[model samples]
Target: MSLKVEFDEPKCVAAGQCVMVAPDLFDQRDEDGVAIVLDDSPSPDQYDEAREAAAVCPAAAIRLVEG
Candidate 1:
């Protein structure tokens, strides 16, 4: 299985929910509060958790695609 993660900067509200949910796959830059995608292409073990983080993002900034 292949999974992809994408984050939209403009739409992000810096809620930090994504980072809070999955710190391994997401992060917060010191300059900007907006969440950043650490490993947009996460490993299989992180797939479900990454998806969960995406789902919990209040700004809906995370996008996941499965293949």
Candidate 2:
């Protein structure tokens, strides 16, 4: 009924798009150029946008866990 997201830091390449797409769900640390999850549970309305963000990630660091 919902979605889950997890990021592998070792695979992250500091592309801040995910944060840009969903500020409520993610944050980018400009100092280190890495994304940090701000909230694990994004609203259902945001699922599509979040999935798109994951798809566009240059490093392919985002994982979509179907619920």
Candidate 3:
């Protein structure tokens, strides 16, 4: 199993929810606090965390694609 994480910068609201939920996969920029994807493809074990991060995003900026 493989998981892919996608971050929509323009849709992000700097909420930091994704970072909080999955720090290993998501981060926030220091300048404007925009969300950034640290790891687009995370290990299978991290799939749950990735999904939680996407679900917690208030702006719906995080997307998780399973393959």
Each candidate structure's TM-score, on Cα atoms with residue i matched to residue i, is 0.93, 0.86, 0.94
Task: Give a tens-digit lDDT track for model 2, residues 1-67.
Answer: 8888888778888878887787777888878989987766667998987798788888888888888
Let me know the TM-score candidate 1 reaches against the reference structure: 0.93
RMSD of each: 0.8, 1.2, 0.7
Candidate closest to the true structure, highest TM-score? 3
Off by over 4 Å in 3: none
- Put down candidate 1 lDDT per residue, 1-67, tens digits, no spaces: 8999988888899889888879999998888788888898999999988999989998888899899
Q: After superposition, how far is residue 15 of candidate 3 from its true place, in Å?
A: 0.6
The CA-based lDDT of model 2 is what?
A: 0.82
Please report the TM-score between candidate 3 and the true structure. Answer: 0.94
lDDT of each: 0.89, 0.82, 0.89
